[model samples]
Target: MRQANGDVRVGGPVNNRDVAEAHNYHAATKHSYWSVRLGGHFLDWANKPHPHKVYQGLPVVPLPCDVTPPTMAALEAVAAFPSMGTSIRNLAELAQVLFFCGGLTKKKVYPGGEAQYFRAASCTGGLYEIEIYAVCGDLPGLSAGVYHFCPADFALRRLRAGDLRGELARATADEESISDAPVILVLTAIFWRNAWKYQARAYRHFYWDAGTILANLLATAAATQLASRIVAGFIDTRVDRLLGLDSEREGSLCLVPIGAHSPAAEPSEVLPIAPETVPLSKREVDYPLITQIRAASMLLSEEEVRVWRSGFAPSPPPPINRKCFPLNTIKRDALPNRTLGEVIIRRGSTRQFAQLPISFRQLSTILERSSRGIPADFLGGSGTTLLDTYLVVNSVENLPTGAFYYSPSEQALELLKEGTFRRKAGYLCLEQGLGIEASVIIFFLADLDRILERYGNRGYGAAQLEAGIVGGKIYLCAYALGLGATGTTFYDDDVTEFFSPHAAGKAALFAVAIGHSARVPGRVKLLAPGAR
Candidate 1:
């Protein structure tokens, strides 16, 4: 019964021969009319998961808040590589990266006295399930230890007191890129936090949410002149053991090594321990589907990780020889003058988009800025990505109203079937007004067959995560230009069908709507803060 989209049976360990768990999970989670009509899922507000995870009885190490905010232009900062020839000199600089990446940037108190803390990265359901931890050799102003970043109070809680980069390097198949780094940041997700709202589908958010933070993490690192890269191919259980996490309830997602100077690290020695924790809720409901798919995606051994990373060569799809609209983006000198830290602080998902047209330059700038390429382990080699961008242009300065495919190589939009598709665009995005009202909606589609064949079910997670990263970049780019943006869910099969032949075998992974915010009239003006 593995027909996908509807009839598919996925059970037991997923092998290379049977890589249908991702297909099944993707199919099972599709948001179609029939599925939504029949599947009744409701939020249990009384049992909501706590917003923060606190380690009981650990000494608090407050991070410095006076770290200088990065002054580089947000567009150039987000678009450039983190290969700068500089290093993280002290904890304040690292704190700058951490704060911009995951720390709370602003707090809003509602009239009801309920205080809401907005984090740097955009999270699903505002449920911040992702957690950040650091493992490092000794560095200025900080010691060699394993510490969890407590964003609630802007502090670190030490979990182990020793250098563990060697252990981390080994868990990542001796990835040499991170060997000389003074610090490595590990991202993990606690199951119950997001599952409280999304159920089994929360597994997908593990990466989607992290991808947003990573978008900021990479940009901030580059702005701070630190070299960094995302390592996704690591021994899952080993990393979990390193973090001393309860494997089923919480697990590692990826590791990022920052800076390039450090001494050799000692091997990790983690004892069997479950540190005490504050309860997240009065009770937690278990989602077996999450565990099932997470297991299906796990790499059992270090050698397996190496092999998986080695085989991550997904043959590029057929090239787009037919370039349609030539892209005209802003010149480097004319790019936005806003600092990344300032844009991050002011950024919020646009809840209301004005029914207006954004200049062609703005549209092209966002595309060019976000598609420069992402730096992650799964995406080996230069400019490698699994998802292709498709667009439904509703209103723009000079562009025609139609659906088109974005060719990063050609720097052009391949004209798919052209015509006004506002109604169709809204329907594809689950009948949301935001999709219809926005000047344009961007859809990310991935070739699951090719990706799964190369990296097994785990590639599914990477694809979603990558989409999130690109969407996150689009979000930041929009805000930097004094516009607004928001992420939206789509009707999977319908999106693929709308772009036929060109998008035939692709799976719809993510979508984002971008345009001017309604709160401000015509076009909002942004202040350019002077950078250091």
Candidate 2:
């Protein structure tokens, strides 16, 4: 294994109880909540990390702007989750998928005169660290090879000049899905990108942010009728080397096989390329803690991948001893059929929302879609839930606004209390006003104690990934309804308390705000040449 500063040995199989305790202690004492506040004040946003990956004098191609695919037809939202079979297997379709999933969506001029461009998913610190690469067989227009997605120009730059899905399939130890996939999406995170703001915890945000993006990718693929699955357990270094990424600086997170094929692919001639890449920022500042936690959880071999992937087990429900609230259930057809594409196009982090009451039906639709079973490898085959969802209902028609617990099994919202928590909601989300402005805020709480104890250090990976998948789905669902949604960070303990007895000991995993957006006049175009 490539050694780096602060790297820990996360190289073994651990049970659930041990993993859970490690996570709990890490969150409570070792890393602790209070440490974050102090750390935040010390951060230098002015001296924030730079964006460009400085290739210096390396010969690089400026991908064409025409690489972006046009947005597709919006399909109505369906309650039942369908496993997509085929897709728009063309260059244009591929470009569209890439753009919608990772392209720059909008640009805003900060009051300080800084123009910040946002992407398809809501990132923790808006640090676009996660990079996407494509490995495929010959398609409609593009060639068969490995290509890096250049979001700046919305194009792909060829790296390896031959079909390499076979190599990936082999690296993944002949995982059936990859063996039959026409295209595979590889997601890798550049550490310093997000760690600039969140420091060590930013490692987790890598999964969180990427998960949200994957959510968009999966939903869009489904709309196009493409088959895709999240493959978290893989030979990390092998895939990293295939993409020619510096494993210490940027590491592969997950692999997604898009579109199905009848026959398996043959392995490519694996050549080792140690081409020197660019530095992400002008002068690099290192954060040891981030690397330590990441290294502790890295999976080294194909056998290890299989072990980690199979070792996962769903978190057991909280003991039935506590008094649970009654829930509000709705019919499946009551949901709208807004095509997933339409939702993604119109979707944005609700920068501003009218605190107007949304109909209870809207709330019901979001809950239904967000919690619908997700297809993932870590999920243990049975739509298993790795995180618990709790909500701070700010306002909704006929629903008393307060905190509540979502029972996916019951398909209902169990009322935990009845009152307004707009201010508390905002406060809990580190004072981001979006929380208070949103109609409903959903918080993902995981029993880290139980999870880590069962899965070991790697449990952290499953928990974050699960939250991201669900959170990402909720984003699409909100947009499908013509509403808006954005992922937000929160004060872990405060969230549990705000939800009270129902969520007392549970730690906050992730959060999202759902509501009507303050519509911008004229469809705001993003990434238009010279438009900024």
Candidate 3:
């Protein structure tokens, strides 16, 4: 399953010659035509690769030792460490980073008595395929080595001996971030794990789920005053080998360098070691298309990596005259005053939305705050949005319950179609009730044809990142407003269909439901950095 270089195709036959051959300018129209005329083959769910990757008859080694859980408040408070110039003096800091990023956040029991442990961030389908490994020098409490984080036991299992951070730096062409940081967090996704439920498109989930976790991590790092950036361009195989991951089952997705100004890491003198990890699930499943797509989009040469690192292909000029709203401006005092720390600690995806209505002011503030310019190189300028926003208004004061397109250009909602489609909303979101019950559901739709033609595979990264940045902001905004929100997976075609004519030709990027939660005051824990 390992390719000599990263040259795998992403979408395979779905976005191939025949599909691309169609001159479909409007995605919603194209989607509607396919669903109504072709009997539902356009947005292919049948081909969704399995979401979980199961391995059987494997070794299960307990992590070296038990580690203490970091103080929740301390964990949440230190979003960026180096910003404060605080040195990481001992082994405890490393443990804090590992646990906070990947530790279990909560547990729940089902009617059948089965227990499910949720993680630090909400994931689509709660299917977590992302895995984290550490590469660093020996610190205060532990030895220098490559180790995989086992969230179940809250311990680290050594995968290789000694410092391999230099090898990683070289693999990334000495990506400056990795070279200077004391510890680098390497993230990889097990193909079959998420592919099982989402199928080939699980490839996107690799980044979507990852982006959410990265949001938490970045925020946590920011609270700590540590400089962190997401690095995608690198020699894939070299990093895979260093981590001893079976390229067939899992591969490196991104690398995050944390902390600054420690002694330079020395490369390991020992040859590459391939130690075995115990099997995680019962039986291994295969998703060839997903593997194929991931491999195709991979970066091979340092030249290709460098070439693909930047540049958005020539985007078609914006419409000479399309009527869209300029995003509404907000008064500073009217905005939610909760600090970033308070918001993150209290945030959780809404499971049930009260039919009770949210105030027009609260809703307006969220739309404004979440749409504010994101800080990204891909964004031409601050406040630039890569994707358009559309909404299904179930209920809002002074607003009709129908489908509306957010003309950020006009800062007003353009009524696309006037109809109550609560049932349609639920169906579009894989039949989730939250969509129907929420005050309004926001859907991010992108012009992928333009994006891909301009940025290639990296465009997908930028789009998802933008959605995540805003989505993360949405979480903060909602919590600060005393509302609730949750990120969700949706039926691609149905969303476009619901917003049709207006949303034609656009592809679904991300979905989040905002409303109210059902938990009691103290039921949901809220801890910030340094808090217990």
Local accuracy by lDDT, each model: 0.82, 0.70, 0.63
Best by TM-score: 1
Top-lDDT candidate index:
1
TM-scores of all models? Answer: 0.93, 0.86, 0.76
Candidate 1 pairs with clashing backbones: none
Off by over 4 Å in 2: 1-37, 40-47, 52-84, 109-114, 262-264, 311-338, 518-524, 527-532
lDDT, candidate 2, 60-141, per-residue tens: 4344345433234332322333345773476766776777788777776655566777776667767888889888888877
Q: Is candidate 1 or candidate 3 better by TM-score?
A: 1
Please give the TM-score that candidate 2 achieves against the real structure. 0.86
For candidate 1, write residues 1-532 as lDDT tens digits.
0111222244446653357777877877777868667766788899899988999998677888676778998998889878544767787877888888887766655555666667888888889999999987777878888889987777888888778888888788778667778888999999999988877778888888999999999899888888898888888877888788988789888899888866456575666557788988988777766766777788877888888778366565567656488899988788779999899978877778887999889999999989887778888655678888999999998888998898887788877877988889889988988888899999999889989888888888888889989988998899999999988877889899998888898889889999888873233222221110
lDDT of 3 at 525: 38
Scored by Cα lDDT, where does model 2 land?
0.70
Q: Write the per-residue lDDT of candidate 3 for residues 1-532, one digit (tens) a residue.
A: 2222222334434322222322231232222324444432232344443332332333333332333432324222322222323334445666555555655656555656665556666666677888888777767766777777766665566777677788877777766767777777888988766755554556667777776776666656655556666676677878888887788888888887777675557565536555655554445546565555445556666665656556443344234244333433346555545555445544567778886677666667677656655333345444566788888888776677778777554557777777888888887776778778888888888887777665555566557766765676566567767888888767787787777776788888888778776653224333322222
